[model samples]
Each structure stands twice: as structure tokens, then as C-alpha cells.
Target: MDVNLQFWSTEGKSFFQRFLHWADILDPTVLLNSNKKIEKSRLLLQTNAQTLQEPLQDKKVKEAWKLSLSSVHPGTGEIIPLVFRPPAFLPLATPLLFASLLPHRGAKQAIIWQAFPYFVMTQHKLSGPMQTFFKRILPIPLLACLSVFNVMIVRGTEYENGIEVMDKNGKVIGVSQKAGLKAVQETALSRAALFGTAVIIPESLLYFLYRTNFLLRNPHALTPLRLVMTVSALGAMLPVSFSVFPQLGEIKRDDLEKEILSSTEETELFYNRGV
Candidate 1:
């Protein structure tokens, strides 16, 4: 049976959803940072628990508040460098207490709120390297294999069942239904010559784009997009290779599983730790 593959639409999703999805992935750190900051503030509150000293003026508080959390966080494997400074909010009223004030720059609010509950309520637990590498990298490679497909030319006059042919008028040409019983050798080659020839350009272009974004902002978006492109390249190439020699398409999940399972414990604990 012939199966058709579809891909993620170029059509975009709402910005908030994308932002939140990234937040979902990144929330552990954000939450950790936020809660740590709140705790710092609360301690400051408890110690200097006096009423606000003449409404909070832009007058600089202590140089800056810094907290360095040294434990490994989950999911992304990152160390949380939790830092907090008093919010730079435009104070409307005189500062009675620092706790009474709010930050002027509220852009971090959603990030803070999303992470706060998680920080307060939960402990992050994530997979070790063997599990992680397989869970993360395996799907990406598989995904890449699925995303791009290719057609190929075969040497023999008798066509294979899965092969597709096109005529000059954009009509699909069918191979002869007749099959010979004698075993025949097949030599398969790529249908899209240009794709095979210039694969490096696309791969390099994606890398350049990713690096440029990394240099500029290094935001969450750049990382995933880079992953998408990287996987896209792999995906694009795998099928093309398969089309050229269909036997190359065969991937043994059993072998892959064994390899991943074997290395479960010796993997670096910190590599599995989130930064």
C-alpha cells in the first residue's frame, strides 16, 4: 500500500502558544530563579522588616542581589544561575516597604508567574544521558527521515512497486505490470539530482542562519529553529539516500534500543543535569 506523508504547515501558530510552549520547556529554570528571588526578597523583608523609607526612590538599593543555585535542574540539563534585582518599576507612591513596590519592567511577569508555582511545588527529575540521547536524538533523526522524501531511478526496465514516474505533461507514468520470476539486480539513483548535488549548501546555510541568530540574541526560538533545520537536513537526506538505494532505508530499532540501554549508567551526571 502506498502511504503519503504530510509535514508541519508553513502557516504559523499564535505567538503566545509558541512562547508558552518554550516556557513549558524552560519553566524549571525560570521558576527556580523567580522563587529564589522571591525568597531573597522575603528574607530581606524579614530582616529589614521596617516600613518603607520615604517611598522607594530610584535611589539604588544594594549594588545588586545575586543568588547562585548549584544543583542540577531537569529537562534541559541546565544550572540555574538565579539572579534578582529590585524591579525597575516607576513608583507612583512613596516607598513604605520594598515589598509594597512592583517592578517597572513587567515583561518578565508571565515568565515569573509560570515558573513560580513549579518552583514552589515541585522538584525536577529528568532522564539520564542514555535515555536522554535516545529520547531526544533518535526522534530527531527519525523525524528528519520522515519529513523529506525522494524518488529515484532504477536501472532495470522492470519497475519496483513503490517507484513513481512522471511524463512530460505532468502525468504519472506507470511501469509495466509484468514481472519476471528470475531474480534481478537493481541499481537505484536519485530522482532529484540537484538536491543530492547541493545538499551541503542548504545544510551550511541553515548553520549560518542558526549561528547568526545565536550571535545576535541566543533566544529560545533560534535553538529550536536550528534543530528544525538540522533535522530537516537529516530528514531530507535520509529519504533521498533511501530512494537511491532502498535498502539503506532499513533502520534497526532493536540495535538502537540495545545501544541506548547499555550506556544508561556510565553517562555523565551533569550532562544530564540542566544548566
Candidate 2:
């Protein structure tokens, strides 16, 4: 990020030193100061102009200084260019833009469909008092499933407290429970648990609020109120899944060690159960 130059010359040491001093002020991108004759002659003019108030000698010294500053070395012309941009800009951006268009739409619809079945099944074949009662209570079971998904279990060695998350540089970024379970099962359950909980919790509250006429109604056309509440509730969950947890993060350092110690003792008792 920072650049500097080193000047070398064969003139009398004092004169060459003065030229190097002047060259230091120019802030050249490359090093080039091998001409001792030019150095001494320019140094003399520069020294003379510093003491004089006349414009003509000042102009002459300025020209000499410009010539000295402009010279470039053919041998040491290694220009280290400024690299200010990231290398992966295009590759990263293209996928993200395309993802926003096609894949994201399908993924979002599938997520909604998966969650819809839980909601619809819970509300199945019930009406009036029964429908209202199940709506109020079904979200609790969904929450229990979610609590299990959020629950982190550790079951490995050389992994801290059964958790191991590392970066590309072999540095531990954090602890992870993902490795403890089969990858496919963990991912599928994690998604199902989260989506189920997300849809249930807010929908239950909104359903009651809608039935009781607690939410404000749009004036002119008179919307179905429940439809409006459902849409709003669904919109609210997006921020919870994407923004809320990500922004409010937790970092646990000694946590893994404790979990590992506990899991070790717990596992020993299990294997010794029959014996």
C-alpha cells in the first residue's frame, strides 16, 4: 500500500547525498537515481535558487528538478501495481443475482409448502370452538420440536465439547454440533423444525388476534382480516430467520470443553449399563 524509492550515485558523496535528499521529496513510484553528473549539477542550481528571490533562476531550477524527477530506470522498472479490488467479485455477484431470480423463488415456495402442511394438518376437520382451541394449542408442540432442533448435541473426540468448526486456515472459528449427527438428517430436521416453529408461533397469535378483531382493518374495501393477519405474520418470520439471529450472535469459548466432559461421562454410563 505504501511505496518509496532508494537513490544511488557515484558523484562526490556530499553532492550525491543532496540529490538523494531532493529525490526523496518527489515521491517516485519506482527507484531511479544513477546519474551522478545530473545529480551534482541540479543540486547546485537548487541550492542557489533557495537563497535567491528572482523568478528566472527559480524557473531554471524548477526545470532541472522536473528533469531529475522524470528519469526512469530500464533495469529496475518493476512497477508494483495497486490491487484494490477483490478477485471473486464477478463469480460471487453473478450467482447471487441469479439466485435472487430463479432458485430463491423455488426454494421460498418449497419452504412455504412444507410449513403449510403442518399448519393445515393441525387445523384439519375442526370448526368453531374446536378449530379455535387447536389453533391456540398446536403451536406448543411445534415449539417443542423447534427446541430439539436448537438443542446442540456433541459426540466426537479431538472436537471441543463435541463441537468443531474450523476455517480454511485450520483455525477454530467456533464450535458446531453439525458433525455429531449424520449430515443429511441434521440438515433436514433442522430446516423442518425451524420452518414448522416459525409458521406456528406467529400464526397462532395472529389467528386469535384476527378472530377477536384486535388488528386494525383497512378502511375502504373491508379485507377478510384473517387473510391480512396471515400475510403480515408470514412477512414477520422472514426477518426472524434471516436478520434477527444473524445480527444477535453468541460466542462461547469454554462451552465446548464443558459439553465434552459431560458427554464423556454420560456415554461411559451408557456402555456400562448392561455390565
Candidate 3:
């Protein structure tokens, strides 16, 4: 039994290493940096060959390094910077904007409505189990509502100007009157459903695991283990959520305005249904 356990552990480690290597290949930043490294190496080799007879001076070597760093690849003709900024806050921007647009009473009511669930969950008087239960369940509904609101705000903004209609060749023909609103409604419903599914599945699994004492078995490792479990759950759910709906939304040409249909020969059209 001990030998079997050791073999399984070794296999698990190998599996994780392979998974990380595959993830690295799929990572955009890593791929970009790798290409940059290859380009820099080639440039250094060419520079070294040219200066082989008379070794480069210290200043010239420094200059060459700087030039290699700054030089863009001939293929892409663009230099990727070393620093990267993640757009983590982009998802929150829409919700904040939606809240800002409401009247004073409406905004106050919205804030209170959203905050009430959190307040109840965090109340000091509540028992630990009750608090944990609320914490797990409340986020599902709250997130679903917020997702719907975000979709409304986005679609409302697009409705003001209308969405661009394109021809079969991908050329913009004209704007459709209510096509944007319809697309937004469909996307919003789909997203809300997906959000609920994604949140509920993980929360349910975690709740069960917690009840079984699977997560609390190792007191010293609890925090890191929970974090890893959470990340793994999200990673597993993302692909399933994305697969739930078709990203390219289809609309009948007849649903569009007369002018738009006349401009395009196709009876059906497709547009990116925003996530």
C-alpha cells in the first residue's frame, strides 16, 4: 500500500508538471517573450560574427545589448514591452457606471439591496455555519443580478447609436435599428444563466467538501489548499461556461431595418455577442 501511494504521488507530480508546460505554451505573454528571446539571440550572433576579428569595446558591447533589446522583429515589426498590465478591473467598470447613472433614491436603493446580503452574511451575531452557508449561497444570486445589470448598461449604450451591420465579406454596410438591443438581451440572459451555473456548481462542491472535513483535515495547509482548490474549480468551470453559448450571435436580416437589409444581399447575419 505504501509503495502504491508513492507511485501515485510521483504520477501526480508528473501530471502537474506536464499541465504547467502546456499552460506556458498557451500563455500569450510567455509566447511573446519567447519570440523576443529568439530574435535577440539571432541579433547577438550576427553582431558577434561581424566583430569577431576585433573584439567589441565595452561601450560598443553595451550599445549592442541596448540595440538588441530595442530592435523589433522583422516579421511582426513590433516590440513587446517587458512590463505587463492586467485588465482585472474592467469587469467592475460597467457596474459602477450603472450605479452612477441612477437617480439618488434609485442608487441608494440599489446599493442597499446589494449590500444587505453581504451585511447579513457578515453579521457578528450569526453562527459560524449559518454565516458560511449564507456566504456560499448569496453570491450566486447577487452575481447573477449584477451580470444582468451590466448587460443592460452595455446594450443600452449600444442601443443609443445602434450596432454596426456587416456584409458577407465583413465590410460594414450600415447600422441596425434594434439589432443591438436584441443581441444584448439574448447575450445577457445566456450570461446570467452561465454565471449562476458556474457559481452554484463550485459553491455546492466546496460546501460538500467542507461538510466532509476534506478541506479542514490539514489545519496548517488549509488556506493554501482552499486557494488552490478555488483556482482549480474556476479553471475547470471556465471552458464549460464558455461552451454553453455560441459566441457568434445570429439574427435574421428581416429583423433589421429595411435600409440595412437592402444594403446587404445575405438573409442572415452574424455578430459578436459580447461576453
Candidate 4:
């Protein structure tokens, strides 16, 4: 009994030590310090600073460092710490934090649209594998449609008064309803493409993982691994998806209504192609 107690105590100490090591590695402060060091070194080289303190004294360098340490509003130039920036930090920390916790009607609709079809499909008497296959395939198109719908709803309403028709000198001319609608449509198509890729690629990889019984082999780690895979797939595709569409939507003067073209100074018009 004494020998057994000693063995258990030794194992407990080992487990505690491993946990501490991992905790240190995962700590945000550790990551922050490492980032700060690398950035400071870069700044020093760029500015030809004799010391770190010299670089920090520059007003622009100070602002840039602050921006690097946190999130900033591109339009307003408002700087907020990572913890304060709900959009960036919340999604990284909690997968469904904004979906469930926030008062976003669009997010709620997206969840329902993605979920309701699966619930209905499950009611029918289908084989387990068949049900799984249908569950994966059906949501892809639904999500794509939802993405388009969301884009139209958000951008359509925002530009309901018509987008500002700018001249070559960036002066605001008369608004153009047709131009606004065209911009919204372009954004909607782009969103549909992004959603389709994000859903299809991850689901395809997940299907293969299941077929190989990867989850079964590591049953305890299944949920975490699946979450990691989904997040990673979306993260990898997000930049590529965004780059697929130009943010500055363009339209020819001929495409606009006769009145709008005659009123505007420029031969061509541009509007914001929202994400």
C-alpha cells in the first residue's frame, strides 16, 4: 500500500509539472512579450536607433506599436486593446460567442438557416451514413444562399438612399440608385463564393477524417480536434476569399441611368464593395 501511494504521488507531481509547462506556453503575456521583442528589434533596425528607448520616442513609431499590440478601426482610427475588440478577440476565444451572446439578428438567422434543414432531414428514416452525407451536402448551398442574403440585406439597406457618386476629384456628386444596387449585387456574389468555399473544404476534410476513423482513434480529443480543423480551414480560406473580390466596385458611365451620368462629372463611377 505504501509503495502504491508513492507511485501515485510521483505521477501526480509529473502531471502537475507538465500542466505548468503547457500553461506557460499558452499564456497570452508570453506571446505578447515575444511579439514585442521582435517588433522592437525590427523598429530599431528600420529607424537606425541606437537603443529601444530611442525608437519608442518617435510619435509615429509609438502609434504603430500601439496598433500592433491591439486592434484599430481603419476608418475612424480608434485604437482598442485586443480584449476590448469584440469582433477579433471574441471569435478567437469563443467559437459561438457572438452568435449566441450578441444581439445580432443576422447571426441568429444564419444559425437557423444552417440548422433547420438538418433537423428536418434527420426526422426521415435514413441510414446513419446517408444522413451524415446529406447533413454535410445540404448545408453548403444553404449557407451560400444565406451569405448572399446577408450581403444584400446589410449593404442594400446601408445604400438605400443611394451611394455617393464621387467625381474624379473625390467630390460627392448626386447619388445613384443603380450604382448602389450593382455594388450590392457584386458583394452578394462574392460572399456566396466565400461561404461556399469555407463550408465545402472543411466538410470535405471532415468526411475523409471520419472515413479513416481518425476521430474514433482519439475519441477523447475528437471535439477539440474538430473545432481546431474547422477554425483552421476557415482562417486559411478567409484571406483568399476576400481577395477574390475588389473592395472598390466600378461601373461604366453607360451602365448608369442617363440622368446620373449627365449630373456626375466623371465618366466612370466607383462605390464601396462591402465584405
Report the number of the highest-TM-score candidate.
Answer: 4
On residues 1-275, what C-alpha lDDT tens digit does candidate 1 reach at each position?
A: 10000000110133343232222222233334455454554345234423123212322222111121122222122333333111111121112111211222333442232233223222433346644443223433332222223112222333243222222222323322121101122222232332232234344564576666763675556445544444455344432332332211121222222333343332211111001
Candidate with more favorable, higher lDDT: 2 or 3: 3
Residue 27 displacement (Å), model 4: 19
Clashes of each: 15, 2, 0, 0
Model 2 misplacement above 4 A: 1-131, 143-163, 166-170, 173-228, 246-251, 258-275
Q: Which residue pairs collide in model 2, if any?
A: 161-256, 161-260
Q: What overall lDDT goes with each candidate model?
A: 0.27, 0.34, 0.49, 0.51
Name the lDDT value of residue 6 in candidate 2.
16
- Candidate 2 per-residue lDDT over residues 81-133, each given as its tens digit: 22211112222322322221121223234222234433564557567776554
Candidate 3 weakest ten by summed lDDT: 1-10
| Alpha carbon deviation, residue 100, candidate 4 (Å) | 11
Report model 2's TM-score to 2 decimal places: 0.27
**What's each prediction's TM-score?**
0.19, 0.27, 0.52, 0.60
Total colliding residue pairs, candidate 1 = 15
Candidate 3 lDDT over 139-192, as tens digits, reads: 567777777887788668666777766554445667765767776777677667
**C-alpha RMSD of candidate 3:** 15.4
